[model samples]
Target: MTGHHPRQAVVTGSDSGIGAATALLLAAEGYDVGLTCHEDTAGVRATAAAVEERGQRAVVEVFDASRPDAGATVDRLAEQLGGLGVLVNVAGTGHTDRVVDLPYERWRQVLATDLDGPFLCAQRAARIMIAGGHPGRIVNVTSVHEHLPRLGTAAYCSAKAGLGMLTKVLALELAEHGITVNAVAPGEIATPMTGIAEEDAYREERPGNPVGHVGHVNEVASVIGFLVSPRASYVTGASYVVDGGLSLMAAHGHDSATGWRSLS
Candidate 1:
């Protein structure tokens, strides 16, 4: 299969952060990677170089996953790579406006990027995988917000929650084809998305996290690497939470400002 390139994968929003880490890991695992980034051309190029350094071919494209042409990019990448063996949906946007004040356009933008984008990309990838007889892996990068409601994150929470459910449904549908579908829910990963500097080696202490610190993109990518590997053949329809026990604190209530306990 073209020397050592035995498999191929398409990862969206892979210019940086968890997406970039996943791409690098997959590349190191000997999969030629196709990546999409909206604005960070330099970051995308760096990721491509990293993949090549790992001895895997890399293709980069500028893609806005929220657009109608989102799926087209996946299809194109898959075509260029000859076929598809993995699809990781990491392209998404988050909105922190309160529901009461959230503009309709903003809500739509978040949902379009986080939910519709994944669905469209997955749909195209699934068709290619099924048609090409490639038992593929589909991993959607959701968030802890998929399971827990966060303050001022109505749109993001809703989109990720919908993506979690979509992963399960896709898993069920694709199982007959031997294709696995899953989600990786990361919480507070140290990435530019979280306002963390790329050069800074910082870990914020979280009282709720048993791990006692924020996660690194590679930590979440390691989980994704496993999920997409042959070792995870039997694992599907699952949402792996990489939050380091942050979700477990849901039972711990917060002090109330109105004399009643708040479950914040």
Candidate 2:
């Protein structure tokens, strides 16, 4: 198994958005995919149908990422898929409340889902890969907020930043075992989470972003596909920013003299 590459992959939060796109893309690339969703049973089924239409096996599961036993869900999915050689951590929650107005429970929920969940899932997947003596890929879906601070998303930012560090640490620790860990940070993607529809991505105007439009989910998915593909075998412990240059507007964002303090 030293030189073998497993063709089975698991993607969390695959009910929609980047997760669904990633599952579909991986299936197209000849990997059987295991899809998971928290509450969107119908959405996950839809994703599965699309995967099967592409002639690849797709298994669906429903589990809350904020739960302590989320890692168990990964293990079950891996077992069902025969084995997991690629894991994409995409299940996460967002917050818009300022720190002072934020509730402790909400903070905990965001951190648990965005940070703790990925840790648990990655740990389980790494164990499976090591035990099977196979090289593996783990890609965590963070956000541009992971590297930049925002006005009202204190919890979301903190959690994503933590996950980014976790990615690097895992990459260093797992390198000797032939496992690569990386993070993909996206900005203003045309996903349900961003309140943007996939079909309207190109039509949506985002003047602040260099691309001048919202990003399509596939743009981010393509990067993840590359990270998990054989072509990126030497890439690890890196964070790929798929923001259409949105993060680069930090200086421009601050140059504004009007309503800048209230900017999100």
Candidate 3:
């Protein structure tokens, strides 16, 4: 990991899973971490402890990413950490429902968190970085759904797809300020979101995933680590897919009745 002088970074939804993993990795890579959790204070505390154990400072806050004031949380975190150099928008949510049966509220919530949240956080972080005269990195944690659709992920797919395009536009706007913007799309990673604990073996033989297994949180975090590094200065307006080739199965359609029958 390379940083010109990234003293601080904010990772939203850092209570557990990929967010926690990224926070710890960034801390080890010499960054003071600003962490946020929607409701998991204990999990955030544990994550903060791990950052401190690595001799890096950690500040934790709580806020709902779907709210309009989401950017205010990042503003406060940056102030608490003294400054901000990296902003990783990992706060996101989703629901499983066919578009015909999906509730309006559910759809709104997904878009709010997955798309609106990242835009606001990136906007605030970029402003802070520019005012402070620091080149910055903005990495949005999207999903493989950004490129491919799932059976019952209408809202999730739409939100991620929108975020993908948003990432490119922001990259173009922020390029003049030396602020690189990008997205990371992961698939079937071992995380609480996927109902798999870190100790569990999420790797199962699957027809979709060519690697025949699930991915680890750290695997996704490592890609995020590199994107935010100085080495990736020219790698803006891109979405890095971190799946085990699961997304490549998009072209190969399976029989709905025989292939599998699970929404997950």
Which predicted model would earn the best TM-score?
2
Q: Which is the winner by TM-score between candidate 2 and candidate 3?
A: 2
lDDT of 3 by residue, 1-264 (tens): 223645799999999999999999999999999999999999999999999999999998997999988999989999999999999999899888998999999999999999888888888998998887768999999999999888899989999999999999999998878889999999988888988777663644455566767788999999999999878988999999999887766545663423543555
Ranking by TM-score: 2, 3, 1
What is the lDDT of every predicted structure here?
A: 0.88, 0.93, 0.89
For candidate 3, the per-residue lDDT at 87 reads 95
Count of backbone clashes for each model? 0, 0, 0
Native-to-model Cα distance after best TM-score fit, residue 242 in candidate 1, in Å: 0.4
Candidate 1 has what TM-score?
Answer: 0.92
Q: Rank the models by lDDT, top first.
A: 2, 3, 1
**TM-scores, in order shown?**
0.92, 0.95, 0.93
> Model 2, 168-259: lDDT tens per residue?
99999999999999999999899989898999999998766778799999999999999998899999999999998888777776555344
In model 1, which regions exceed 4 Å deviation?
A: 1-6, 198-202, 255-264
Whole-structure CA lDDT of model 3: 0.89
Residue 12's lDDT within candidate 2 is: 97
lDDT of 1 by residue, 144-189 (tens): 9999999999999999999999999999998888788999999888
